[model samples]
Target: MKHVYGTTALLVATVALTGCGDSDAGPMPGMNHSSSSTPTSAAAAYNDADVRFATQMIPHHQQAVQMASMAGYQATTPEVKKLATAIKAAQDPEIKLMSGWLTGWGKPVPTPSHGGHGGHEEMPGMMTEEEMSDLGKQQGSMFDRMWIQLMIKHHQGAVAMAKTEQANGKDPASIALAQKVQAAQTAEIATMQRLVGQLPVS
Candidate 1:
C-alpha cells in the first residue's frame, strides 16, 4: 500500500511540474522559432514590391489631399464639401502611415509629384499641371462638377495600383493596406459617380 501511494505521489508531482513549468522558459507566445533565417524585424520582411507600393502611394495620396484641400474653399455643393472633407481626413493620415512604413524599411519616401521629383514613372490618375491649374480656377457648380470628375479618375488610378500591390506584394502589412485601399477607393468612386449624376449639365 505504501509503494502504491509513493507511485501515485510521484505521478501527481510530475503532472504538477509539467503544468507549472516556467511559461518563459521556451519560445515566447508571439516569437518566431529560433532559426538563423528568421527576420530580425517586420521591416526586414518587406520586398521591392512593398517598397514600390509605398513610394508610389505617398505621392498619390499627397495629390488627393491637395485636391480635397481646395474643396474647402472652392466646392459649391454641401455634399461636395462634406465628401472632400472626409477624403482629406482619411488620406492625410494614410500618407503619414505609408511614410512611416517607408522610413522603417530604410526606403526613401517619394517626393510629392508637385515638387517636380524626377526619375519615378508618372503614377496613374495624377493631374498634369495644366489640368490642376484649370480645376483650381473654377468656382461654384462648375468647380463641383470638375472636382467630382477628376477625383473619380484619380480614385480609379489608386484602385489599379492597389490591385497590383495585392497581387504582387509579399509583405503582409503592405498587402493588407492594399486590400483596404482598393475597397475604400472603389466605394468612393461609386459615390463620386452618383454625385456626377446629380450635377446639372456642364
Candidate 2:
C-alpha cells in the first residue's frame, strides 16, 4: 500500500510537471489584455484545421513554456536564459489568444493539455523522449547545451504547426497568430543554432 501511494504520488508530480505550464515562471510575451481591442471579424469562423491546430497547439505551446521556464533555474548563461525567457513570454499570451479565438468563435477551447508530448509527428524538430529525459537530468554546461538543442527542436516543431495553419486555416485570428509564430520561431531557430554552436557539447 505504501508502494502504491508512492507510485501514485510520483505519477502526480510527473504529470503536474509536464502537463502544467508556468509553475515558477512569468507570463509569456505580449500577454496583456486577452480581448484584442476590437477583435478582427474574420470572413468565416474556425474550421476543423483551426480546431486541430489550437487543440494540439495549446499543449505544444505549454511545453515550450515549461522548457523555457526551466532554463531560468538551470542555465548558466544569459543568452540561454534570455532565449528561454523570450519563449516563455511569447507563448503565454498566445495560449490565451488561441483560447480566446476559440471562445469568441463559439468553438471549444482546447482540451486541457494531456500527458505525453504533443501528438503532431509531422511537425518539425521535436526531441525524442530520451533527449528530454537527458535534458532534465543535466546541469551547468551540459544543461545549457541540452536546453539549447531541445528548445531549437521545440521551436522548429512550433513553426511547422504554424505553417500548417497558415496554409490551411480560414479564421483571421488563427491565421494571424500562425504568421506571428512563423516569424518568431524562425528568428529563434537562427538564434538557437548560433547558441548551440558556441556550446561545448556540439
Candidate 3:
C-alpha cells in the first residue's frame, strides 16, 4: 500500500509539471518580439486608390455644397431651405474630412476643375453669373421650382461619384467615407423626389 501511494504521487506531480511550461523560461529578451504579426487596420493600409477617391470626392462634395447654398439663400419654401441646409451641413464637413485625409496621407489636396476655394464665387452647380441674375429675376414659385430641380441634379452627380469610390477605393477610411456618401445622398435623393412633387409645374 505504501509503495502504491508513492507511485501515484509521482505520477500526479509529473502530469502537473508537463501541463504547464517551465516558469524559469520567461519570454525571450531584447530584439525578440511576438511571433504573432500585428494586423493593419483599415485606416492604416491606405494606398493610391484611396488617395484618388478622396481627391475626387472633395471637389464633388464642394459642388453639392454650392448647390445647397443656393437653395438656402434663394428658395422661398421652408422645406427647400431645410433640405438645402442639410446638404450644406453634410458636405461641408466631408470636405474638411477628405482634406485632412489627403494631408495625412501626403497626397495633394483636391482642387476643383474651375479654381480655388472661394466663397460661393463660381462653384459648380452654383448659379452662373447669368444664372444668378436670372434666379434673382424670378421669385415665389419660379425660384423654388428652379432651385429644387437644379439641386436634384447636383445630388445625382454626387451619388454617381460615391458609387465609383465604393467600387474602386482601397483605403478603409476612404471606403468608409464613400459608403457614407452613398447612404446620405441616397436618402437625400428620396427627399428631393418628394420636394419635386411639391414644386410649381411650369
- Give the CA lDDT, 0 to 100, for residue 76 in model 3: 81
lDDT of 2 by residue, 1-202 (tens): 9999999999999889875665444332222223233232241456888877877788788777878878989999889999899888998988887766667667666543453654646445655567767888898988998888778778878888899999998766677788999998999999988988888762
Question: Please, what is the whole-model Cα lDDT of each candidate in the order they appear?
Answer: 0.80, 0.75, 0.67
Q: What's each prediction's TM-score?
A: 0.78, 0.72, 0.66
Cα lDDT over the full model 2: 0.75
**What is the TM-score of candidate 1?**
0.78
Q: Give me the runs in candidate 3 sitting further than 4 Å from their true place.
A: 1-44, 111-138
Let me know the TM-score candidate 3 reaches against the reference structure.
Answer: 0.66
Residues 1-202, candidate 1: write the lDDT tens digits: 9999999999999988887786554544233332112322256466888888878888888889999999999998989999999989988877777877777778777766435535324678877777789999998899999999999999998898999888888777677778988998899999999998998775
Clashing pairs in 3: none
lDDT (10s digit) by residue, model 3, range 76-97: 8898889889888988887887
Between candidates 2 and 3, name the one with more favorable TM-score. Answer: 2
Ranking by TM-score: 1, 2, 3
